[model samples]
Target: MKIVIQRCSRASVTVEGQVTGEIGTGLMVLVGVTQEDTEKDAKFLADKVAGLRIFEDEDGKMNRSVLEIGGKVLSISQFTLYGDARKGRRPSFIAAARPEQAIGLYEAFNEAVKAHGLEVQTGVFGADMQVELVNSGPVTILLDSRE
Candidate 1:
């Protein structure tokens, strides 16, 4: 599993010209599932993201987690994260799991996040989405479960 987490003042997803999911003052998560991903991977990432201390503290230090700031999460499925373009002009998606298998894990990941007691929003899986966000502090983090 891999994710690109961005601190955002607000975020929303649009599919087929219709707004699907949106949030304010939260994190925007571009989630990716690999062929080897499992429920365990989802659980680990959800827990880690919930506890990640990227939000600022009273003293203006990055010491508070998103949960502490009453923030929300906008999770988007992005199978292209696994695109391997190392040796060719075209990107190869062999590392990404097939849609059937990926959907279950993707839903499981979001459910895991919700299970952590946080508000979790999401985009339609396998849809062409237009995501908009006001990146707060422009703070971004990359997470990988393989490690």
Candidate 2:
């Protein structure tokens, strides 16, 4: 499993012109899973993202975790994060996990995060969706569970 986390002042996801998930003052996370990913991978990343200290503290340093600031999470399923285009102009998504396998792990990740007392909103898995976000500080970080 892998994730791209963006510190956002606000974020939302729309599917078929309907808003599905929304949040304010939080992390906009794009989640991906591969065929080799497991439940443990999902749990690991959930813990990491919830605890990562990217928000600034009063002392003017990056010292506060999302949990500390009571931030929400806009978690979006994005298989394209694993797209491979090294061989040609078109990208291949062979490395991405099938929807059946991915949805469970993705839900597990969200559940784990919610268990930490953070609100977790999510986009429709495997749906064509539109995402909007105001990236606070333009801060973005990438994480891979295997690492």
Candidate 3:
């Protein structure tokens, strides 16, 4: 499991001109589930994302976790995070999990987040969606479950 986490002031996902999910100050998680990912991987990644201390604190220091700041989450399933581009101009997506498996893990991940007591929003799985976000502080982090 790999996740690209971006702090955002606000974000929204729209499918077929209808808004699906949106959030206020929180993390925009581009979640990717690989063939090797398990339910434990999803749970572990959810805990990691929930406790990450990237948000600023009283002294203006990045010492507060998203949970402390009363933030929400916008999680989008993104298989392209596993795209292997070392070969040629064309990137190979063979490393990505099959849609059937990926969708299950994606839904599980969101459930895990809600289980952590935070509001969670999500994009439609396997849909052509438009995501809009106001990236806050440009504060971003990359996380991998294997790491």
15-59 per-residue lDDT for model 1 (tens digits) = 999988999998999999999999999999999889999999989
Candidate 2: the clashing residue pairs are none
Native-referenced Cα lDDT, model 3: 0.93
Q: Clashing residue pairs in candidate 3, if any?
A: none
The candidate with the higher lDDT, 1 or 3, is 1
Give the C-alpha miss distance for residue 144 in model 2, angstroms. Answer: 0.5
- Displacement of residue 46 (Cα, Å) in model 1 is 0.3
Off by over 4 Å in 1: none
Residue 26 of model 2 has an lDDT of 88
**Pick by lDDT: 1 or 2, better one:** 2
User: In model 2, where do residues sit more than 4 Å from their true spots?
Assistant: none
Local accuracy of candidate 3 as per-residue lDDT tens digits, 15-45:
9999999999999999998999999999999
Poorest lDDT segment (10 consecutive residues) of candidate 1: 109-118
